[model samples]
Target: MDDDLHPDGAQDGREPRSGGANLLVFLALLPLDALVGGHAWLVVGMNGWAAAHNGEEATVPVTELVVSGGVPAAAGLALCWGRYWGAAVAQFALTAVLMAWLLSFQG
Candidate 1:
């Protein structure tokens, strides 16, 4: 094809993506976001491990949960588009342990 004129595979731009590919990627990533958000919810809103395993009542106020957990996750999610997306991924990965560790200091 005339598309690959360059040996380096540069044909003025990237190849076109399929709509299904994009949708599939979004579907794949949805659980990751939900996992991060759920961890935040469990930590802040539901008062950590007890809520997850024992059905303990949520002791935290909604506003506090939003401020403490939601903001950091949002910041991490915002980094998804840039080179710093790794940091965002790390933030998501660390959300549960980090929050649990921090909140332990208060209790």
Candidate 2:
């Protein structure tokens, strides 16, 4: 077996470090999701209404709803399934940017 695959020297046969790291990423993002407030729900509602109306006169594309809701979800999933560190970094960066943007209005 490759040594690099088991950086923590797992001779006792245990799951890789990435799994725990991914779980941590998932856990960390949960609060960020909450901090996002009701925007996700609002996006869903808008998309649903627009779909029912055949998107006629819709101000935003349905894809916007998916993106608005998917970013955090995808980040979590990515951490679990793909690059754990990358996902964590991306999630933290996004959260910081969002929080900064929200706080910017407080003068």
Which 10 successive residues of model 2 have the least lDDT summed? 98-107
What clash count does candidate 1 reach? Answer: 0
- lDDT assessment of candidate 2: 0.56
User: Distance (Å) between predicted and true CA of 106, model 1?
Assistant: 18
Residue range 57-87, candidate 2, lDDT tens digits: 3343335444554666566566645557655
> How do the residues 13-105 of candidate 1 rate in per-residue lDDT, one tens digit apiece?
445445555445445555665665566556564465556578755354445544556655775666554334445565666565555654553
Question: What TM-score would you give candidate 2 relative to the actual structure?
Answer: 0.36
Model 2: residues with Cα > 4 Å off, grouped in runs: 1-15, 18-20, 35-37, 46-61, 77-107
TM-score each candidate.
0.36, 0.36
> Which residue pairs collide in model 1, if any?
none
